[model samples]
Structure formats: C-alpha cells, structure tokens
Target chain A: MSFDTKENTPGTVPANGHSDTTPEARPLLIAIAGNPNAGKTTLFNALTGLRQKVANYPGVTVERKEGNWKFDPGRPAARLIDLPGLYSLDATSLDERLAREVLTGRLPGLPKPDLIIAVVDATNLERNLYLVTQLIEYNIPVVIALTMVDLAEKRDLKIDVEKLRSMLRIPVVRVRTREKTGLSEITEAVRGVILEEREADAFWIGNAGIDASQQADEIHLSLSDDEAANRQIFARYKFISDVYQASVGTFDTERANFSEKIDKILTHRFFGLLILIAILLLVFQTIFTWAALPMDLLDQGFGALGETARASMPEGILTDLVVDGIIAGVGGVLVFLPQILLLFLFISILEDTGYMARAAFLLDKLMSRVGLHGKAFLPLMSSFACAIPGIMATRTIENKRDRLATILIAPFMSCSARLPVYALMIAAFFAGQTVFGFISVGAVLMLAMYSLGIAVAIAVAFLLKKTILKSPPPPFVMELPPYRIPNLRTVIQNMLTRAWLFLKRAGTVILAISIILWALMYFPRSQAPVADESTAARVQLENSFAGRLGQTIEPVISPLGYDWKIGVAIIASFAAREVLVSTLSIIYNVGEEENEESPTLIGAIRGAHDSGGAKVWTPLTALSLMVFFVLAMQCMSTLAVVRRETNSWGWPIFMFVYMTVIAYAAAFATFQGGKLLGFS
Target chain B: MEKIKVLTLADVAAGTKAKVLRVSGSGPVPKRLMEMGIVPGVWIRVVKSAPFGDPIEVRLRGYSLAMRRNEAESIEVTE
Candidate 1:
C-alpha cells in the first residue's frame, strides 16, 4: 500500500543540512545520461568502483545498471542509475524510450531522478548538447559533467567552462575520469544541487527560436503527440546551435587526426571485409587452441573427482548418484567456462574501442538482405561460443522485430556445448582421413559443421523476416565513437560477471536437473540375480524409467538413424547438449566389466552392434547425430533465458517447437540422403 | 545568378561537403535525424561508403554517423 516510501521519494531534501539523519537514510537517485561512446560508462565505473548491480528493466531486456556512490562520509550515499546511451529524448528505439520514461516517471518501480548528470563529450559539444538541452525541458535539476576536453584541446579547440556555465545557467563540472581529476568536484556539485533543489531555467523555450516557437504553438493545439514531438525537435536543435556559438571558442579544422587514419584501412571496401574475416578466424582459432589446455584440465579434474567419490563411498544408490548424476552433470556445463570467458573478453574490448559500430557498418548490406540489422552480426557470432549470452546481447538491436528474429535464430549457431558430441563422433568415424596432404579430415568435418550452423541460421532468419516477423526495416543510423584504448578494469569486470552467471547456473538449475536425471536412469533395480556384474548392470539399465522412455521414442527417431540407446542420450541431452557425450559414456561403461582401466568411450561406441549384427553408429549415423545437435533447441538454460528475456513463455515455446521440427527434418534428410549415396 | 541545386544526402559523393537544407520525412526518423545534428544549416561531409553503398559514413558536428541510404535520402542538402 506504501508505494511512496522514503527510499522511493523523488526529490525530498532534509530541511537542515546538518541534521543527524541515520546513515541508512534513503539514498538520492541520480541518473547518468549520455550518447554512446561519450565515456559515460567509464565515469560510472570510476565513481562506483565495484558496487554495481546489472539487471533488466521490468518487462524489457535493456540492462538497468545501478551503483551506490558515497562521495563524502557526511552526505547520504547516492544511487546512480546508468541508463543506456541515447542520442535524444524523442524515443525512436526501445532503449531511448526507456531513458525518457525513467526521467519522466512513466516507468513503473522507478522514481523520477532527483538530479541528472548529463555527461557531455566536449569534442562533440554541438551534438552532445542536444540531449542536455532536452533534459533541461523536463524541469529536473541538471548538472553537466563535461568530458573529453583533452581531446578537444588536441583538436586545437578551447572551451571556457565558466562561460558555458553562465550561458546555460547550470553548474558545469569539467571531469577527466582517467586522470581522476574533477570527480570530487562533480560530486560536490551534485550534492550542492540536491541540497538546494534548484530547478532548471526555461531560458531557451521563451527567448530562442522565435519563429519555430510560433509554429510549434500553432501545431501544438491541433496536432497529435508525434507531430508535437517533431515540432519540439527542430526547436531544440536551433537552440543548441545558439548555445554552441556563444560559449565555444575557435574551430580548429586543419588536421586529419588519428581516428581518420585508422578508418581509412579499417573501412576500405575490399580490405575492410577481408580484415573482418581474418579477425573472426583468429577469434575462433584462439577459442579452440587457447582454451584447449584449460578445458582439458577441467575435464580431467572432474573425472578424477568422480572416480575418487565412487572409490571412497560404499556401493549403493547414493554413491552412484553422487559420482554420476551430480558430478558429471555439473562438470559438463562448467567445461566451457574458458571459452565463454574468452569470447566475452574479445567482445567487450571491441565494444569499448568503438570498432563494433564500424563492423556493423561494414556488414549492414548483407544483414539487411536477411532482414536483420547489422548489429545482429556480433550477437550471432557470439552464439557460437554460447547462446544464452548471445541472446542477451541482442539488446543492441533497437527494433523489437529485429531483436526477436535475432534471438530465434541465435540457437542455430553451433555452441561450444556441442563440441564434445562432434569430437566424439569425428574421432569414431573420420579419424586418419585427410583431404590435402596436411589438413586432417576430422578438422575439415568440424569446420563444415560450424559452417552448416551459420548457413542454417542465416537461411532461417531470411525466412522468418519475410513471413512471421515481417515489418518494414527500421532506419539504421548509428554513431561510430572515436577509438580509445579499452580500460582494463571494465573489461575484466565484465568477464568475471559473465563467468559468475554461468557458474551459478551450473550450481543451481544444472545440479538439480542432473540429480533428477540420475534417478531416472538408476531406479527400479533388477530383482533377478545376474551371472556377472556387467550383466547385472545391463539388466538394471534396461528396466529403468529412462530405458523405457527411450524405447517408446525409438520408433519416432529411427528415420534419423538413432536407436533406443541413442534415443536415451538425446532425451537426456535436452538439459544440455554436452550431456549426450556423458550419457553415452555412462551407458557404454556400465555394461563392460574387464581390464583395470575402462576402454575409451569411443571404442565402446565403435564396438556397439544392433540386433541384426550391423555396427550401430556408422558414419552416416554419426553425421546425422551431429546435425541434430547443431540445430536442436537442446539446452534448457537457453530456453529459460529466452523466456526471461522476452518476458513470456510464448516465444520460448515457439522457439522450442520450431527448432525441434527443423532439427528432426534436417537429421532425417541427412540420414536418408546419405544412405541413398551408399554411405553405410 | 545560378540557382542552387538541392539534393538528398545520398546524392553527395565521398569527400564532398554539403549544407543541410532540411530533413524531409515523417515519424521518428526525421526527429532522430535532427537529434544527431542534421539540421537546416549544419555542414556534413561524406566520409566513406560501405562495400555495397547502402550504409554510408559521414562526418558532421565533430562526430561520425553511419546511416543507410534510405534514411540518408530523407535529408535534403545543398552542395
């Protein structure tokens, strides 16, 4: 009933500046607004240090980041809300609209900000002031945090901050976050403005743009909201130019500068695209080679821990569950952490340095052909590392239709979780074969599988854009922020945050699902005595709940060249694609009782035969299995993330059904087509 | 006196400078264009074009902006 608690109060200041309010008093909310690449995030990170929380705005996928900033011991801590960067308040995109809504008290669960710290890029004062001027019209107290003054000076332009402050009639704090200069001053300015509760002066609205003002007034009476917004936009720009002329001194336009020099080669028509492809190849190669050692160590460590648990515990259901269900299941998900970390590292660096916009610009033509924005390219590429983060990264796409389409197709990329399944199959079927003198046949096959995933994703995006998600393409206008060296602190912080999320999922959802799956395969122990341990183990598995389910589903999947055992693995893999390899290893190892060390799981699979005495996992079947894993919506975590991101079960359910249908059809075609081509 | 020729932003060649006459479109597109400082009197230079010439880069207001040709066509400019 108390929606307006003291903590949620919009702009209430204590009557006495020296009042002994508790340190736990409600913190004032300050929202930081700026254009992309204006060093706003850098300033936020610098002020908050390590006290930030990243969450989604209610009912939207745009990230809402808030941190606590305590400038002085005597003053109340201020809660800083870092809104997504936007060019203006006219709200063309969802991100821009969210900022506008939060400022105007339209968004639920968020109060109107008490003070706005408008981070303006001093180098681009004319354009950055556009948003600052718009913020003034809302009647909220505004403090301009001027940044990039060094860059402006390097360009031979000098800015008189005192003159600008007098011209705008607002407090202006020139800040250099890198040098740690003027931060305390900005904080003091914020504190002063908050205590004073000063209101913005509506100087531009009355005196400037007289003709435009008359036109806006005439149109404001009869026009709809959209037309009125249009009228206000022109007036705001006209006012910004007048402010630019009065306070800014000397235009230095003689030099080409460093950014233009870099752009010449990076945006070249032919060479630019070639460099992009080479960069992608290097990224993938690093993921495979650089992460190989860490992945192997993790795999061995998990295997050793499972073995130790099995050896120490007495033979019983509890021991089997501990070793197989819990250890194997959680380990399966954690094995890809290294690859995920590296992927995010590369992405964050690219974004911080401002190359992402250029990449999007280069790829816009091809992406538009598939009915996606160029921004979709990076998210789709990230899907190859893992789909959960990739789906979250679609926040960069502004249009709802484009974002949804990108999300729906993101899972089609072959994620790292499927690597184990592909490796197992390739080792069984394609080992020792080579195309040229040097390239291994298995490596070629792996590349082909990755290409297949990308090809299918693009084709599906093309189809979905033209049909179900059809809408006119949104205007593609984006800023290419000047290049800067990525701050090490922000990159590492992002990498760790993503890694923590993955580990937490492994600990909770994956752990519970793994335990349940163990019970399914371990229940209904055999009553009749068997001749040996291997026979007894086989009988117990066949009579278990999972075996019965696999048998029931075998008839449906036979056309895809899968047997009951393969069917069981496929069903268990619905929790995670990597579980297919672990499930198969368990099924094969349980029925073998010979030698000190168990034969490799690949050998067991190779030795498997059907009731008719033909080898079960032939080359065609292995290829078909890989195809199924590539396309299927097998990860429960991805589905859960999609549900959360879209804020509805409808899109996740639709995604699951469509992906399953496509995966089954593709596998069936591959199996039947391969058989016709005389591959056994 | 020769009449000044007014052309859309898409008609400007790379490295050429043009002063904006007006932004002509409806909906949020025009509003957004104006917000990025493509107003009646600002000068913008065509910086570069993408491989297919769909999304082109331009330098204006001391910053770089990339926009599709369709969106650029809405901005009327005089060379």
Candidate 2:
C-alpha cells in the first residue's frame, strides 16, 4: 500500500523524487530506539555527528537528544530523536513514559516519528527483538539496524540478513558504525519504506493492526495477575524463536569468548578490588596532575583579564561591578570547565568501554550499605574534584530517592575548591608541628578533614534514605554488555555535549549569584574616603550589607569560635570557597592576595588582633573553621545545579539548611570540645 | 514416583546450567525480572557472582544479566 502524505505533518517535503511540498519545508521526525549498551549511541552519533542537540525533556531531568540527518544525497533532512534506552514499552519509569508519549504523538512539540530504526544488538538477538515485536504494532514503517554482527559471527552464530528481513516482515541492514558499512543501505531502506508503507500485516502477532503500547498498559492494569502479559511474552518469543532458528545457525559449546576471558581476570574477587582501587588512584592522579596545569592557567588568565579591565577602565561603579562582579563570575564558571570536561572524559570512556558496570558490580555491596546504587560510586568519587560534574553524572542512577541522596551528599566529598581554605588554615597554625612526634600535624589534619567529609557523606546518605527520601532498594538487574575499545570520536562528542550543557544550564545562574554577592559587599559606598586604600577597603567592608549581616550572625558563630570578621569571610566564600583566603586578606589589610599559599596571608592570620587587643587567632579556631568548610554548602554553582537537577528549589533549599546546621553543630563541637581537651 | 528437586536460581552455582521453571513472585521485582526476558522454560547458566557475592551474573538468551540473590530467589529452576 502507498503511504498517505496528507496524514503526515504538512509542508514537510519528502525529497525522494515525489514532492507534494507547500510553502516551507519542515523536517520529518524519525526515532531510534534500543536497549542500553546496545551500541545505539554509536549508531546515532555515526548518523548525525555534531548535528545533535541534547536538552532535558521539559521539567524532567531525563535528557532529550535530537539531531538532523538527510537520508540520502539531495534528500530532505529528518529530525532524528534518540530515545532513552528501555527494556519494554510499558511506562514503569519516567524515561519509558516519555518514550511512549513521543511514540504515540501525545507529547507536546513532538510528533510521532515518520520512520523508526530499531538498533538491535545481534549478539543479544532474542531479547532485543522483543522490543521490535512491539514497534511494528505502531503501524509506523520499521527497519532494523542490526549492530555487532561481526562479534556475533565470531561466536559462530551465522545470521542471514535476507531471511531475517523476510521473517520479520521488515528491512534488516547489518551496520557497523566503525567500518561505515550499511549506512546507505539502511538509509535507502528507510527512504523506500517512508515512500511506501508495509502492506502486509505482521502475521505472528494476531492483532498487529492495533497499537500494542497503548493497549498493553490498559490490558496490564485490567488483567491484574500476569497471565495476559505472560501469554503475550511467550507468543512474541515463540515467533522470535522461529525466525531465529531459521535465519541463524548456532554452534553449541563454543569456547569462552573474549569478554569472559577478560572478566576472568578483571572481575576476580581480590584482583578486581585491587584493579578498581588502582583505577580510582589513576583517576585521582589524573585530576591532580593533568587537570592541575589547565586549572592554574585558567585561574591566571581570568585574574589577568580582571586586572587589565580594572587598569584600563575609568574609576566608577560600573567598572568595579563589571570587573569584580561579572568578570570574576564568568571566571568562576569557566575555571571549573576543565575539571568538568576531564571528569566526563573519563566517565564517558569508562561507560563506553563497559568497565563502569564492572566497577559498579564490584562496589555494589559497599555502596548498598549506605543505601545507594552501585552506579553512585563514580559520581561520588568525581565529586572530590567538583560537585557540579558529579551532580550531573547522577543521570546514570535511575531511582529518584537514591539519585537525590547522591546529589545532596556529593558536596560533602570535600571538593578541590575547599583546598585553598584548608591550606591557609593549616599553614597559619599547624605548620612545622608534629603529631605523635613523627607525623606532620598539618598533613594528618588534612587527611582527617577529607576523612571527615567521607564519614559525613555516608552518614547523610544513610539518614536521607532512612527518612524523607526513603524507597525500596531498586531491583538490581544489570546487563554486562560486551566490552569494546572506546571510540574517541564518540567519547569526545558526548563530553563536549555535556560540557556545553553545563555552561548553558548552570553557568548563567552562577553569573547572577556572583553579581548579587558583589552588590552585598559593594553597596552603601562610604561617602567618606580614607587616606590609606587598604584601610578604606577594610572600613568599607565593615559597613557593607554583607558586613552588617555577618556581624548580626557573630553571636551565633561565637560558639564556633568565629568573630564578625571571620563571619564576613565565611559569607564571601559562598560564591567560591577559595575566596575565603582573599576575603581574609582584605579584612586583615594585607596585599590583594588570592592564593592561600601566600606567606603574607598566613602571616597575617598568625598575628591578628581584635578591638580589645585580644588574640583573634587560635589553633583551635583554625581547626573549627576547617571543620565548618568540610560540611557547609558554600558554593552557589553547586546549589544552582542541584536546583536544575531536582527540577525544584525545594531540594536545594532543604540541602542548604541541613548542611549549614550540620556544619554549625560540628564546628561548635570541635571548638567547645577542644577547649575541654586543652588543645588551644 | 520420585520427588523432584526445586531450586532457586541463586542456588545454582557458578558455571552450572539450569532450566527456569517459573518466576514465582508477584512484586515489581518479578515483573521487572520477567520484562528483561527471564521467563519460564528458558535455559539459563549461572555465570559468576560479583566480588561482593550478593549480585550474581547469569547468561540466558545469549546475554549476561546480573541480579541480587534476593531477586534471583524468585526464579525457581531445576538443574
């Protein structure tokens, strides 16, 4: 039967020598669906490289990835949407629901796809076809893009493409994205089907004329006890087994495959644990060694840019605001870009190579102890670099409560931004001192602080899962996909897409927050000017809104052994935790120092006095401040990302209040408890 | 007539083969397990357990799937 062009969206011309175009041409919608780790991503990238846009589905954290592709030369392009990987058409998860909505043309702004490409992993034929069985029911022209045929054939499983095509009543194109094979064949098949729909009904499924997805749920709800579903499942498999047995030849008792051989060593109980730790160490080292130089260069580049703007521009509020507020805000955003890109590079590589699942498998038990999924391991590990990327990485986790709990406790990993704060506090007081007569006290304290963050994170995750964010332990049915050498092109493409999303979604919020923070510290310009510039800065900070607010909270912080000046520093650090050092420098009237390693900043901290000529600096106070930074939610960019990820302000607000209270109580305990132990 | 032994999938050791008799749970766990193609009369082989020993891997329908022992208990099998 010929396809009806009238029912399709008007004005979208099919360029296959048959044009019924009117006015403007809107692209036809095509969709690609498959199971996770089935090489669906590779095929989609191969078809639509660099032409894709990744965005979150409206008001949901699930990503909606779409790209434009022309089926053949001189043909009109179609918008190809890569749906989330799913096991079935049933709407048990949000991803599945979204896929159904789009499939049924029920989702707003997205029409039903004019064509469907089922990316089937040839090695896993039976289960993959289970989805294909449901796809043909939609009455859309369906084509199979069979992937990994080479791997399947290597296992002595021979597949006849023509027989498969005939049995399934659809076109089957064996495509290997790496070799660039079968791309045009698949395209031609698609073009042919789009022009002329499949006339013969799929005889295997008795009622193939009706859409099963729409009825499957209704039937499932009404039938109630699994009989209908089991029957349907068996019927589909019965049909599948016939096609499989006819079109494929299997050599039984084949020797262990390459994946099994590799897993023999990689997943060994003792060796697997050691290798995992080694890989983690490698990741840790890469962050410190490779990302360090780029981070430093970005830091210096932004600092120099800010200085040049201040030097060349005229003295006014606009100059200060642009240089201090806007430029610095943008700097804070891009400074983390290197870390985010690096984190995703590793994550994408691990995930593509399929080792991430093994990592998850190995660590699943330890993570579950804290009420988290095994996949939460990487996100929490990468949070030590920065929570922005870590929070974004939680997309791998499917359970809502587990994902939120992971996001909430990620910042407690003591990110790199907290390093400068720790450096200054340690150098000023604990420098050159030895704990237990041999170990450097500063080093011990640093390790203790990191340990403290880890301890607090585990506790928080446990508490959250037991309390409000509680849910049943998600069923652990994971497929160990065959490992492949990571494709650099795909890894980099995914990395860049994630990095761009971070800039657009989280960057703008950080810019706005920085301006407000600047205004808080910049407003009510003291009409009276002082002779000394440094003294003028100190005086101005004391009168600014932030200064007064910090003073108002001085009594609350006093129990934590902090004065109003320290309170102001704490407030300034909200935008960026590293700003604590620079804020202390300005308040102490030291030079404009940003680096915590600067000797003058530490020296100033060592010999500062309050209004009563009492020593404002004490060793116990430094320890308390370090404890506070370990738990406090100080970074605004993290909160911005949290708000976006949770799709609500409520979670972020709750996160902030809980973290601050915990920080306060911990700091109070440290200061008050240390006094009892006579450690001052 | 001799009594036949009924064993859960978890009792199947690594490298052992078994035929799935039935999936016996009514919770979402069994529903999901079935949705992923673990049904009655399928021949499945126990692959291996993870380093932690709770979630064990099984090869069925030519692909390896990992699930916890608790969920695996729902699948009644006979060697």
List per-prediction Cα lDDT, in the order shown.
Answer: 0.81, 0.81
Per-residue lDDT tens digits of candidate 1, residues A1-680? 01121121222332222134432456777899998778888899989988899877888767788999996578777889998898777665778889988877678987667778999999989889888877765567788999999999888778888888987778999999999898999988987886665654534342243443444446556886555655566666677766777777554432566887898998899999998889888998898899989988898888899889999999988898898789888887887899999999988888888888889999999999999999998889899899988887888787889999999999988888888788888888888888887899889888888888888888999999999999898679889888889988878877777667656644587888888887888887779888877666666667789888999999999999999999988989998987787667656754321211234777888899999998888989999999999989998888888887788999999999999999999999999999998987
Score chain B of candidate 2 by TM-score: 0.92
DockQ of 2: 0.62
lDDT of 2 by residue, A575-621 (tens): 87877887888888885635777888888888888889988889999
Q: Which residue pairs of candidate 1 clash?
A: none
lDDT computed for candidate 2: 0.81
